[model samples]
Target: MKKSLFAPIFASALVLGLSACGATAETAEGDTATAVEAAQPAVYADLGGEPTGPVYRMAKADTLAVSGFDVVSYFTGDGVPVEGSEEFTVRYQGYDYRFASEDNAKAFIEDPAKYAPAYGGYCAWAIGANDALAPGDPNVYKIVDGTLYLNFSEDVATRWNKDIPGFIEKADVNYPTHTPDEHYQD
Candidate 1:
């Protein structure tokens, strides 16, 4: 008898699909769109001006920074935001980061400033545009001068690309103003 190695993988995929379907069906009135929108984790939401020091922009329910994506992989690997595993993790500036490998995690611990995204993982374009704090999509990013900049979306990223240097300058000036201690004041 011939044995297929893909059997387990296929079964796992099927299980995941079925579970996802179950979740979709459980939404009120079969409103998949509303369910999806509600299911999405907000990038950042103001918590009554509560102070968080220098922590990165993370969802209230999220414990990992950059939505648990490996930051080091963006620079060392294919520049694709790969999800990080809990096995290899690090905590910096009140935010936890997961890494694809222990080596990446160690590299981050060695020089966190080198790997952490700019503007505290908030949307770079929004910072430059109006000093607004918006959730940054890890997938929509760029590495300029060894610095990673994330945007709210592809459209916002395109706007930032129009003048990267100019926007960077503006963002640099505006970032400090939006720091947790600075912006979260009454």
Candidate 2:
């Protein structure tokens, strides 16, 4: 897998993911890190200003989710994600996701959870192995058991492949504990 050329830009746009990730880590003394350490994402849709914890990559109030990639494309055609269009956007749960075309957008609306990334688009390896939050690179990902899972980068993806099922098992338990209550579960 290749790293996203716009990783830095996407990181800036989705600082919420980093902030939520940073907030979940515990120090050796059992104290937790605060969201103050990093920029926070704006709370949107039903959050009512509450922190989103470990939801999807969208900046709570921002419209760009999944790095503006078409989630439907991840499951169709060449099975590679393509850039979605502003003209074909869909709001699922709370965040807005774009699609490459109207047909793709419709596909996503029919059943979002089927297309949504596992672990709320956070790094599956980090969540499973460390119970930690790390930015997921849309460019570097894998589909397992029909679920999309992203990693921090190509290097992280390599480490993730070593034990996909084991990490997923760990993440399955870890993710819901950190994610906000308002979001859907799978």
Candidate 3:
């Protein structure tokens, strides 16, 4: 099946900065001006399913969640995160997540919330401590209880460790301020 080329474009806008419901655009010609219809809520059916919750923050490059890292790898095996394989990729929460193997993909399909990162994969320090949006580095991560959390970097990760429990508490309270699919809310 063919993919929806427009989905990524709208999804990118949603990730970078755009309205949660839909984005608007304008066009003008001669003297008459027209406001084009706002982007429809993209279904992303080709991504395996429609987005269910808050929009996931994609990695800066290639726009893949966890920068294409296999989220399932964080919990299984040696506990070392591994690069995901294109052959076994799955889309969850509006982001395409790659896996190291088919089993990993199946595992993710079984329970996405269990493997998905906190704060929509935004930086733990930024969300909890600052209530801000910052890129999360898949390389710097931690599994607290059964939930996964990603930090901006080693330095930020170190800072976050200073008060993991406190930060988690603050993040939980702050996270809901913005809509699930939005990085920041009005």
Candidate 4:
């Protein structure tokens, strides 16, 4: 039997086409965008050297949410994570949110859920891809459907962009079960 090169090409094309079809870009409001916007790389700083204290987590951890960046800034500013200041802060749902301005802090306090990142600030890709808990890099993120989602790194954020809606759905489903405590036991 002779092997056909076109067979492999056709298979590859079909796979690519199908994968593209499966990807969806939905706005935070659940409305689909006609075209997915180019992902803006998240800006972050290394806060690892900072003192560890009571912080927010889907699983108990000593790291602040979104690396202490102003969550409200993602939506209000040029869609970049603005480093927050300690002067303006709000504690909501066991997490402390630092704000770049008093106004941003006030806005967040009004509706904390609206500003908080998905998956308790854990890496969205990690949760969706493996149901594992990984620290979400404040500098690597995406805002989908008006919601903020963080990834472990810029590479993971790019991968997560491939199937934003799909990953969001998967992460949503897995988040409740895959917590820090749950993973620690395993």
Each candidate structure's TM-score, on Cα atoms with residue i matched to residue i, is 0.66, 0.67, 0.68, 0.64
lDDT of 1 by residue, 72-162 (tens): 9999856788988877767665567788887888888778789989987888898888877777889999999999998989999999999
Clash statistics: count for each candidate: 0, 0, 4, 3
> Among all windows of ten consecutive residues in candidate 3, which has the lowest summed lDDT?
34-43
Expressed as tens digits, the lDDT of each residue in 1-186 for candidate 4 is 124545655655665565567644567688764332312112222222222222234333323466679999989858888988866756664455678987988788678778888887778888898877777878887888888888888888889889888988998888877433332211
- The predictions' CA RMSDs to the true structure, in order, are 14.1, 13.7, 10.9, 19.0
Q: What is the Å distance of residue 31 in model 2 from its true position?
A: 54
- What order do candidates take by lDDT, descending? 2, 3, 1, 4
Between prediction 1 and prediction 3, the one with superior lDDT is: 3
By summed lDDT, the worst window of 10 consecutive residues in model 1 runs over 41-50
Off by more than 4 A, model 4: 1-63, 179-186
What count of clashes does model 4 give? Answer: 3
lDDT value, residue 130 of candidate 3: 94
Show where candidate 2 strays beyond 4 Å: 1-53, 58-61, 181-186
TM-score of 4: 0.64
In terms of lDDT, the poorest run of 10 residues in model 2 is 41-50
Estimate candidate 1's alpha-carbon lDDT, on a 0 to 1 scale.
0.71
The clash tally of candidate 2 reads 0
